[model samples]
Target: MKKVCKGLGTVLVLLVAIVVIRASGSAQLDAPKAPAPLSVQPSESAERLGKAISFRTISHQDLSQVDTGQLTGFHQFLRESFPLTYAKLTVEMVSEYGLVYRWQGSDATRSPILLIAHMDVVPVDPGTEKAWTHPPFAGEVADGFVWGRGTLDFKQGVMGIHEATEALLAEGFVPKRTVYIGLGFDEEVGGVLGAKRIAAHFAALGLKFDFVLDEGLAVTKGMMPGIDSPVALIGIAEKGYLSVELLVEQDGGHSSMPEKETAVGILAGAISRLETTQMAAAIDGPAREFFDTIAPYMPFGQRLALRNLWLLEKPLTWKLTQKPATNALIRTTTAPTMLEGSVKENVLASRARAVVNFRIRPGDTVQSVLEHVHAVVDDARVKVNPGEGAADPSPMSPSDCWQFDLIEQTIREIYPDAVVAPSLMLGMSDARHYAPVSEHLYRFAPMMFTDQDRGRVHGINERIATGEYAKVPHFYAQLIRNSSLD
Candidate 1:
């Protein structure tokens, strides 16, 4: 009995020693930087962003609600706002409102770099206009922020690209490789009319870019667990979103004389099953890369778990699942967004419909999700069909490449103390549409976000700080210079 106790204690100490040794070997993530921030006058740029927000280029689910006049006028606004950019770059409109500009570089041998952003913004909720500190479309630049709908959902990205190009043009600095800017007008509604068409247009012309950058992740603070410094998340890939509608049809009867299973009850059961039995979560591909990249910055205990995921994957995964944000990094998320059954409360719901949205992890597909749904629900009464915006997850971009290094270096230039890491984008972006155009697709916007600030996107009081707005142009200019000069 004494020998058994001694053997167990010896094994435990050896395990602890192994964890310590592995964690101690982790190299600190300190990227060297020598570049400085590029120029964008904060107040002036904030005012410019505010004015752009006032255009009312909102995307609606109903096509008739979209005002073409406002979109056309936005093109004119860009013409007036940046005179030098208009004069220097060759501008071509694709799919009516999608604008494509090409800045001719000295060496056409080098493949061009593409920077993209959407011009359209999601509309404010019906009654929430009065709730805003400033009116949603007022384009108010006050209180250290440019307050409006597009401030965060991304008119800033559109303006940032132009501001950088105009500055570079003014300084007589020419790109060694051709630079292309794509401004899609309908990104808020799945980017079908905008980025998809523009990407096809690029393909038809046999233009394969070196890399394409779009807005997704940002410089986030207090978002990462067990890390103190601000981390710049560069999205190497994005999750595909799928919407599946569950339908049930049953015989109608009086509320007092209900059938054993009404349509509403059937749909409710299907939804419950989906919510409870989520897609299997595993650390693979981009998620693995994310954990590995940020492992060095974690506290010793967390560092041990991260560095030794081979032995501790299940326990660490369980720990990560405790947080909603971290749980999303590992699996396909199921969300029941819409449901319709009966108009009156006392009436039996003979026919019911519900929509379940899934943000697919890299290894899963639309077909696979449907299969899982059918297998799990295992009910003949529930009808399942694909809904809007079904797409497969994008292929992972190479993390160890010159394009990635340039992005890291440029991030360090502006955010010297920040840790740069490759991350998976939880939300869909227009960047995914350009996958056919470039294998090297990255999604990152150079704005700072905190835990309290993330809800502002497509939510009330949407705004970006004047100081943060200034960094966007500098980040782009530096990225352009670094990529082009290579």
Candidate 2:
């Protein structure tokens, strides 16, 4: 009896200490103040963004299907619109449409900074073309918004960078650190041909950047549960991509007389089993760091739970898995996008195939995921093979570095109401290709996005508010100025 009482007392004391320590940490946390605002002309900036979107620079997975003329026209449009940028910055075309502009600064000893964005946009689904309020490539300014495909996904960064650089050049503001602006044309399908080559070019010259900034999560509103303020997620790492084809073959027969199991039935069962047995969820790595940073500002209950993640990891992970967005952060997500079997309803399938795509989480590997699939299906007949473009997750960038601080400070200056946090990008970007060039690659786009706006990305009615569209140029301008200063 005495020993049990003593153990209970010790447990109680430890719990109390955990809460007390978490409380102290929360008490010390205060929101950072917003920096002074920089001004931008809404009409001029919006107009330029609109014109940039007018060009249909869509990337097709099959290069032969892509219209090279559209890519060339877009390049010509950029040269005509930003003549000041063309006159001042040394622009070189990488591959065919990849644009790399070098703005030589006063200091040569310091490694340059790279600003990344893509010139290409995903091809609009032909079926959904009529569903858009404005034609996908019309680039019309309507209802106080710039409506176009790349208005949010990227073209915002592409034109925004030029707009900022041109304004700075006109004002005679020269950077103390050299700056390179890289715009890849094949980022939509995969940057293998475009950004990959650009990074190699820099590598051959023994070039290293202080940091590389690419289009990623933006100033998001209403995403986090407890925090009332908007959150700006600077992507420090991106999930790797893997696509595997599951194939099954069986004896063919007529529909009237079928065997006990057919190829389609076996493949479908395997897919079902794979989906039912998901990858183990973990509340660690970048996802945990994100919650840790935001815990202090969350509601009291959420703050307490998050602050005690060591004790409540299981429950928190379960809660995160309840939502798709949060779920992706916690584990490698399995999505079976395409499946094929019989060509006709009357015929039984002799062979079946399905493509299962995975966005690999940090601390997990492509091989591990494949192993998990094989283990889950547990069928000898199913043949599993890795599809093309399988890649492991990119290495995590340092959050404590000056590059991150600069990005956070710039975001605070532009959107003071936002709570900035380091994030793991679920989608692949051109930044992955630049990973070899810099250890400190940060992914952020300086636009304010809401849940509704986020859905518009690669979806119908994609648009950006005139005011929101205006702020992007000023944000890039300030970011360049502050980071370039000696």
Best by lDDT: 1
Over 1-486, each residue of candidate 1 has an lDDT whose tens digit, in order, gives 999999999999999888788888545656665654555577877888899999999987666889988999889989998999999899999998899999998997899999999999988899988889999888998888899998988999999998898888888888999999999988888888899999999999999999999999999988887788899999999998899989998887779989877899889999999989989888887889888988888888888889998889999888877778878988988999999999898899888999899999999988899899999888999999898679989888988998888888889888877888998999888998998899999999999999777889999999999889898999999888887664
**What are the clashing pairs of model 1?**
none
Clashing pairs in 2: none
Model 2 TM-score (2 dp) = 0.96
Model 2 Cα lDDT, one tens digit per residue, 416-464: 7778899899999989898888999888999888888877999998999
TM-score of each: 0.96, 0.96
Q: Which regions in candidate 2 have their CA more than 4 angstroms from the true location?
A: 23-40
lDDT of candidate 2 at residue 412, scale 0 to 100: 84
List the RMSD of every prediction in angstroms. 1.9, 1.9
> What TM-score does structure 1 among the candidates reach?
0.96
lDDT scores for all predictions? 0.89, 0.88
Residue 306 C-alpha lDDT in model 1: 90
